[model samples]
Structures are given as C-alpha cells and as structure tokens.
Target chain A: MTLPIETPAVLVDLDIARRNVLAFQAYADRHGIRVRPHIKTHKLPQMAELQLDAGAIGITCQKVTEAEAMVDGGARIKDVLITYNLLGEQKLARLARLNERVTVSVVADNATVVDGLAAFFADAGKPLTVLVECNTGADRCGVGIPSEAARLARRIAEAPGLRFGGLMTYPPADGAARVQAFMSDAKRLIEAEGLEVPCITSGGTPGMMQAAEAPIASEHRPGTYIYNDRSLVARGVASWEDCALTVLATVVSVPSENRAIIDAGSKVLTSDLLGLTGYGHVLGRDDIRIDQLSEEHGRLVSDGQIGLQVGELVRIVPNHACVVTNMVDAVHVIEGGAPKGTWPVVARGRVL
Target chain B: MTLPIETPAVLVDLDIARRNVLAFQAYADRHGIRVRPHIKTHKLPQMAELQLDAGAIGITCQKVTEAEAMVDGGARIKDVLITYNLLGEQKLARLARLNERVTVSVVADNATVVDGLAAFFADAGKPLTVLVECNTGADRCGVGIPSEAARLARRIAEAPGLRFGGLMTYPPADGAARVQAFMSDAKRLIEAEGLEVPCITSGGTPGMMQAAEAPIASEHRPGTYIYNDRSLVARGVASWEDCALTVLATVVSVPSENRAIIDAGSKVLTSDLLGLTGYGHVLGRDDIRIDQLSEEHGRLVSDGQIGLQVGELVRIVPNHACVVTNMVDAVHVIEGGAPKGTWPVVARGRVL
Candidate 1:
C-alpha cells in the first residue's frame, strides 16, 4: 500500500501537539509559573503560535538566530528570552537586529558576555535585557555559584544599554531543589544590591512535572514538552501516546530473518541517543531494536522473524525530539492520522 | 580578539580537502581500482567536482534527492550512482526524474526493490542499471548469500527496462577477504548463468586503503576519505592534519576552573560518537575533552586547568564528519588560514 506521506518524513500530529501544549501549560498554570515554550523542538512558527495562543507568556530560544527565525516566520512572538551566552560581534549584531522586531533578552554567565551585549546595545534607545545564567550543577554553561551569578547581574545592571533581567538555569534532571536554592540565593544577593530580580527561569522536560519544587522560578522554558519523545517516555514523564512527533520510514531491505533496514538513519532520526539503547522506538513493534545507523540506513533487528517486508512503513519516536526536528527542513503535519500540509521548520539551521 | 569567522561555524580547509581527494585517488589508482567518491560526507557539489577533477570515475549519493541536489547545484556532474534501494512511488518517480539529467544507477538487494525500479523505469526509453547489493557481513543491507545475489541478478536481467549492472556491498571494516569471497562466488554464479558482471563496487573508509584485497571490486566508493574526522583519526587511518573539516567554536562560559563551554554543540558538531569516547577532539588542547553537548553548548572538561578563557576561539575535529556536514546549512571555506566564501551544504536535508 502507498503511504499517505513519503518515507523518512517527520510526522507531527497536530492534535497530539496541541494536547501536549495544553497539558504542560495547565501544569505550569497550577504551579503559578509562566510557560515560555522553547522553540528548539518544533522550530515551526505555527507551533509557537499555538503555544502562545494556549496562554504561554512568550517564547524561549537557545540562540539569537532562533529568535530571528521565529519572528521572521511571522509568529506573533513579542517576548523572546535567549537562554545562551551571546558572544562575538556578528551574533550580537544579529541579536540587535532581532531586538528591533521583538523584546529580546539574553543570558550571560560572565562579564565578557555582558560587556559584548553592552557594546552592541549601548547606542540603542531601548536597553537590552540580560539574565545571569547559574550553573546549578548542570555544568554546561552558567555561573558556578550564586555569588558569581550576582556579580554578573551587577555587571549587567552597571553596563551601558543593558538591564538586569533575572536568573536562568538549564537545571539538572530531578534537581529542582538545587535550582531553587541557587536562584534564591542569587535573587537575595541581587536584591541586597537594590536590584529587582524580575524573572527566574529554569527548565528540563524530565523534571517538568515537579516544577513547583523550584518555587523561585517565575517561568519555565520547556522545548520537548510540545513534542514528547522517547527520552521523556522512558523517564516516565510521558506515555507513548503523548509523543506528538514520529519519524515515518520505509523498510527497504530485510537482509536476514532477524534484520531489516529502514531509510531513516542518523541523518533523519539523528544519533542523539540521550542514553536510550536504540535509535528510536519502532511503533507497534516492541521486539525490534533499531540496532545501528549509517548516514541513511537504520538497522532494525529482532530475535525472530522481523515481520517487515520491503515498502512497509513504520513510525518511530526518536530518542530526542529537538535534534530530530533540526535534522529535517520541514515536517508533515497530521491530524487524527490524516495528512495536513507541511510546516517549514523555520528556526532550523539557525545555530549561528 | 575577534575571530575571522563566526562562532559555531563549520570550517572546511580547501587545501586539505583537495589534498585528501588527490591522496585517495592516487591510492585507488595504484590498485587499478576506479574511485567513485561518495558525496554523503561533504554534500557539496563543489567538493564532488574537485574529486571528479582529481581522477574520480563519478560520484555516489545515498538518496535520489542528494543526486538531484548535486545536479541542481550545477556541479558539472554527469555519472551518478545512488547506493540505495529505490522504493515507493514518490522516490521512484524522483529517481526517474533524476535519471533524466544524468546517468543515475541504483542498487537492490531484494526482488521487491528490483520490481519497484522495473515498474518505474519500464516506460523509459533507456533501462535502469540495477546492482544486486551483497551482504558480506555488515548486516545492514544487501542480499545474504551468493545464491540470493545471483537470484536477484537474474531477476534484474529478466525485468524489462532494467539491466543487471553488477554487485555492490557496504562492507565491514577490515573484512575485505569476506567481501572478496562473497563477490567472487556471486560473480561466478552470475557468469555461469551467461550474465557478465560489469562493475563490482565495495566501499568503507576504514577499509578503503585495503581495497585491493577485494580483487573483484572494480571501484571503491569512500565518503569520509575526503574529510577525515576524529573517528578516522582514532582508527589510525587519518592524522589530525589530514582532517579537512573542523568546527570553529568560541568559549562562551568558564563555569569552573577545569571546565569551559563552547558555542558549538550537537546542533553544530552532532552526537555521532562513532564508538569514540568524547564528542570531539579539541584542536591544540589534547588534555581537554568535549565531554557533553546540549543543543547549542558543548562542555569541555579537563583533569587540570582547562586554559580556555571566555571569548576564546578553538577548532574541534568532530567524532563523525558526515553528520557534522549535515548539521549546518553552510560551511565557511578556509584557504591557507584565511577566510574564503561559504559553500552551502547542497545535499543536506535531502535525506529522502
């Protein structure tokens, strides 16, 4: 049978995505926290608009170009908080241009990033908003301690054309208490200096259910929440039905009784295992394991008869939704198993 | 200091790439084997043109869309081989379209794929070239045994508008003996049936240097040889200087004395470990390891002082080159340590 969609296509179920958006938004609402859905997962302006319409305060982006893509895609996104350190003149110039279109805020863990932003926005009529990113044990990018966070907050407040926004942390999984302690200490320190801490943002989909534990956070930026993936499902945060995006692939070759190959490989599904065993969860086939992947071929193996023929279609929930979304240019939007049109992943390839 | 290129930019050294192409071409020439460089690594029609100009027989693409991109980019590419099973109406129609522009050939390991190709090209004036993909031991794709290869060869020979081209295998590393055994047996069987084996192609970058071990192979299709990555360096196939591609990143944060974060992450470097320990090798900083990666941040950790300050630029040879090439939209071409123009990754996102 000819499938409705082509092989190696990213299928986003609009109904499921809308449900996911509302579920997370409702969760954040009960906790008295604002939802600023990160656009890194879907990268589609329509999806961001759907989140904004679902009562999200604004949006969160990881890079300056992401915010530009969101605004350029014509989404009604007015407030964008870039949760990354903006370094160098080229990116800051782009960020300055984007700020002209929307209210753009950024995060900085050090004074160098603060100074770079200050230099770029120094001559602007409206000063740029800057937040201090606290490490909080993530050890990825952020200030090591609360004192350093306060120091950067002070630097932002003292710098020209920059306003001290708040504190932000891409917290460790299940470490909401640590995030709370770090942000609270930083807030007290900043407040001791007579500067108001406007917003404390912390997020991770694995621990979003317990977001209230980090009571200091005024807002949560969750990217994969709108398109639940295998990682969240494996962490018991979401069920299989909650996954809004899946990779549709066709079985091209069955080399052995226990082995079959699909067209979606690392290039489509990506190699972001996120600690998962296989490349993805083959829907309706629990016994098969996506064992290995080349650039364009995913090896599916089973102990017995693989039970897949050539031209057969299978849907896969990738381990990480954000990386998979970045792999494709566009995705097929589906509603109740019927095909809708395609949505360009506008914010994709905006890593600059 | 301001860097010449932007942070999180992929830098391709044109000189090193040209040297790699010529070196590999020379190796294959000495073995009396044809070189059909796979464009899956760079995905640039310009790089393909360089390889073709440097004594390569043709270019090999993994998908129909990749071939279309190469031709669309106006790369003077004539002969093309798509090393994938063409299935479904959409892909077959695309393959037919791509065939109109160039000499496009494909591989099939099963009767279903062969039938699909036959159905698509049956109405065309010229027949499609079909190679029976053999399963030497990669276990990814291809027919399992010599008898199956011979059986598929006969099927292709009998099908209208289809000609049995030869046998093809994406072989395992250091398994050239098994590949030779498998192909020689299949070639003998097909020849016994009064069919001539035209071009037996086998390839893998790890085993490319040993291409002569598979005496039956008339051509070698090596993708990563053009831009050796950390994986090849780890396998002792290519040195660090031989690596033509590097991710140019800036140190965004130094959260701890022994840890630093770069602007490049999975969005730029990708998560293709290729069985390596870390995400990538930090150039000129062997003591540091790119231990972790988020979507837009790469964490560099060291046992001692990391010695990287915020705003510092560092080049990184990623674990896998092909996936890294697919991550970004364009790569800045560097020549003799100077900046040149950027080349769009033409075949990127053409996973279909």
Candidate 2:
C-alpha cells in the first residue's frame, strides 16, 4: 500500500500536540505558575502560536537566532526569554535587534556575559531583562551556589541598560526541591540587597510534572511535552499516547529474518539516545527494537520473526523529540490519523 | 578579542580539506582504484568539485535528495551513486528525475527495491544501474551471503529498464579481507549466471587506507576522509592535522574553575559518540574534556583548572564529522586561520 506521505518523514500529530500543549498549560494553571514553553521542541511558529493561545505567558528560546526565526515567522510572539548566556558582538547585536522586535530577556551565570549584554544594549530605550541562571544540581550551566546566584543578580542589576528580572535554572530530573531550595536562598539574599526578584523560572521536561512543588518558581519552561518521545516515556513523565511527533519511515530492506532496515537513521531520528538503549520506539511493535542506525538507515531487529516487509511503513517515537525536530527541515502534519499538510520548522538550524 | 565568525560555527579549513582530498586521491591512484567520495561529510558543492578535480570518478550520496542538492548546487558533478536501498514511489520518482541530470546508480539487496526501480524506469530512454548490496561484515544493510548477492544480481539483470552493475558493501572496520572474500565469491557466482560484474565497491573511512588490500574492489567510497574527525583520529586512520572541519565555539559561561560551557552543543556538534568517551576534542586544551552536552551547550571540564575564560574561542574536532556537517545550515570557510566566506550545507536536512 502507498504511504500517506514520503518515507522517513517526521509526522507531527497536530491533535495530540494541541492536547499536550493544553494539558501542560492546565497543569501549570492549576499550580498557579506561568507556562513559558520552550520553542526548541517544535521550532515551528504555528506550534508556538498554539502554545501562546493555550495560555503560555510567553515563549522561551535558547539562542538569539531562534527568537529571530520565531518572531520573523509572523508568530504573535510579543515576549521572548532567551535562556542562554549572550556573548560576542554578533550575537549581542542580533539580540538587540530582536529586543526591538519583542520584549526580550536573557540569562547569565557570570559577569562577563552580563557585561557584554549591558554594553550592547547600553543605549536602548528599554533595558533588557536579565536572569541569574543558578545551578540547582544539573552541573551544566549556572552558578554553583545560591551565594553566587545572588552575586550575579547583583551584577546584572547594577549593569547599565539591564534589569535583573529574576532567577532561572535548568534543574535535574526530579529536581523541584533543589530548585526551590537554591532559588529561595538566592531570592532572600538578593532581596536583602534591596533588589526584587520579579520572576523565578525552573525548566526541565523530566521534572515538569513536579513544577508546582517549587512554590518559589513563578514560571516553568518545558520544551518536550508538546511532542513527548521515548525519553520522556522512559522517565514516566509522559506516556506513549502523549507522544505527538513520530518518524514515519519505510522498511527499505529486510536483510535477515530478524532484521529490517528503515529509512530513518541518525540524519532523521538523530543519535540522541537520552539514556535510552535503542534509537527509537516503534509504535505497536514492542517486540521490534531499533538496534542500530547509520546516516540513512535504522536497523530494527526482533528475537523471533520480524514480521516486517520492504515498503512497509512504521511510525517511530524517537528517543528524543527536540533533536529530531531540529534534524528535519519540515514535518508532515497529521490530525486524527490523516495527513493534514506540512509545517516548516521555521526555527530549525538557527544555531547562531 | 573578537572572533572572526560567530560562535558555534562549523569552520572548514580549506587548506586541510584540500590536502586531505588530494592525499586520498593520491592513495587511490596508487591502488589503481576509483574514488567515489561520499558527499555526506562536507555536503558542499565546492568540496565535491575539489574531489572531482583531484581525479575522483564520481560522488556518493546517501539519499536521492542529497544527490539532487549536490547536482543543483552548481558542482560539475556528471556522475553520482546513491548507496542506499531506496524504496517507495516518491523516492524512486525523485531518483528518476535525478537520473536526467547525471549518470545515477543505486544499490539494492532485495527484489522489492529492484522492482520499484524497474517499474519507475521501465519507460525511460536510458536504463538505470542497480548494484546488489552485499553484507560482507557490517550487518546494517545488504544480502547476508554471496549466494543471496548473486541471486539479487540476477534479478536486477533480468529486470526491465535496469542494468546489473556489480556488488557493493559498506564493510566493517578493518574488513578489507572480508570484502575481497565476499565480493570474489559473489562475482564468480554472478559470472556463472552469465551476468557481468562491472563494479565491486567497498566503503568505510576506517578502511580507506586499506582499500588497496581488497584487490577485487574497483572503487572505494569514503565520506569522512575529507573532514577527518575524532573517531578517525582514534582509529589511527587520520591525525589531528588532517582534520579539516572544526567547530569554532566560544566559552559562554565559566560556571566553576573546573567547568566551562561552550555555545556548541548536540545541535551543533551532534550526539553521535561513535563509541568515543567525550563529545569532542577541544583543540589546544588537552587538559580539558568535553564531558557533556545539551541541545545548545557543551560542558567542558578538567581535573585541574579549566583555564578557559569566558568569551575565549575554542576549536573542537567533533567525534563524527559527517553528522556535525548535517547539524548546521552553513559552515564558515577558513584558510590558514583566516576567515573566508560561508558555504550552505547544500544537502543538509535532505533525509528524503
């Protein structure tokens, strides 16, 4: 049988995506925390608009170019929070232009990044909002201690053409308690120095459901909920039904009785295992494990008869959704199991 | 203290790339083997032209759309080989269209893919070349044994509008003996069936230096030879000086004395570890290790003082060059440490 679309295509179930967006928005609403969804997951302007319409406070981006693409794609995005340390003239100048287009805020863990931001936006009519990124145990980026968080907050507040917005942390899995403890102490310390912490944001798809446990956080940013993947499912943060983005691939070769090769490989599904074993989870085929991947082929193997044929189509929930979305230029949109059309991943490859 | 290009940029050193291309071409020339360089590494038309100018027979692509991009990018590419088991009507239709531009050939391990190619090109003026993909050692794709390879070759030879070209295999590392053994058996079997084995191709960057060992192979396809990466260096196939592609990223945050975060992450460097330990090798900083990566940040850590200051530019040779080439939209070209212009990754995101 002919497939609905081409093989090895990223298929975003719009109905499921909308449901996921609204479900997370309602969860945050119930917790009395704002939802500032990260656009790195979908990267499509229409998906960002859907989140905004579903009661998101604004949108969160990782780079200036991502924010530029989102706003340039004609999304009604008026506010953007770039949750990365802005450095260099090229990035800062682009951030300044994006600031002119929308109310933009950024995060910084050191005085160097804060100084660059201040120097670039020194003469702007509106000061750029800056957040102190605190390390609540992720050990990725951010201040290691609450005292350092307060110190950076003080630096951002003292810098010209910058307003200290609050604190932000990309917390570890189940790290709501750590985020609360770290940000609470930092907030108390910054308040003692006569500065107000306007907003405290904590983000992670793994700890998204526990966002309310951190009562000090004014907002939470979760990027993977709209298109949950096998990683989230493995963490019990999302179920298979919640997965909206899947790679629809064709079996190009059944090399063995136990092995069938699909067209989606590292180029499409990506090599982001996210701590999972296999490349992806084939829907309705738990017996089949996507064992390996080359640039353009995914190897599916089973213990018994594989029961797959060449030209057979399979929808796979990749191990990580965000990276897969970034790998594709566009996604074929599906609603209620029927192909609707396609949505250009407007913010894809905007890594500048 | 300004970087020549933006942070998190893929920089291709033209001097090193040209040297690598010519070095490989010279190696293949001594072996009297044709060089069909895979375009997946640099994905640049100019790089393809350089390869062809270095006496390469043609270029190899993993996808039909990638072939389309390379040919459309104004490269003087007259011949192409897509080393993939392409199935379905859409891909075959596009492959048919690509055939109109250049002499295109494909590989298949099953009758399904062969029938699709035959049905697509049955009414075409020129017949399409089909090679039977044999699984010598790497069990990714292809027929498992020589008998299966000969059977598929006979099928392709008898198929209308298709010409049985030869045998092709993506061999395992250090599998030159295996390639010769399998291809020699398959050639004898196919010849007994009154079919001529015009070409027997084997490919792997790890085995590129040993291409001459497999005397039965007529040509070798190596993608990562042009832009050697950390994996190639680890395999002892290429040295650090031979690496052409490096990610020029800035240290955006110094979270601690032992830790620094770069702007390049999995989105820029990719998550294809290729069985290596760290994400990449940071040049000029042997003491530092890139221990972790998020979508937009790479965590560099050292046992002692990292010494990497914020805003410092560092060049990293990623674990895999081919996947890193697909992450960015364009790469900045550098010659002898000076910045040239940029080249769009013409075949990037063309998974279809």
Give every candidate's TM-score on chain A.
0.98, 0.98
**What tens digits encode model 1's per-residue C-alpha lDDT throughout B33-103?**
99998999999989998999999989999999999999898558999999999898888888888887788
Question: Any runs in candidate 1 off by more than 4 Å, and if so which?
Answer: B1-3
* Tens-digit lDDT track of model 1 for A35-143: 9989999998899999999999899998888888898885588999999888887888888888888888999888888888998899987889999888887778888
Among all candidates shown, the one with the greatest DockQ: 1
Per-model TM values vs. the true structure = 0.98, 0.98
lDDT of model 1 at position B230: 98
Clashing pairs in 2: none
How accurately is candidate 2 docked according to DockQ?
A: 0.87
lDDT of 2 by residue, B42-128 (tens): 888899999999999999999999999999984599899999988777788898888887999999999888988888888988899
DockQ of 1: 0.88
Q: What is the lDDT of residue A189 in candidate 2?
A: 96
Off by over 4 Å in 2: A1-3, B1-3
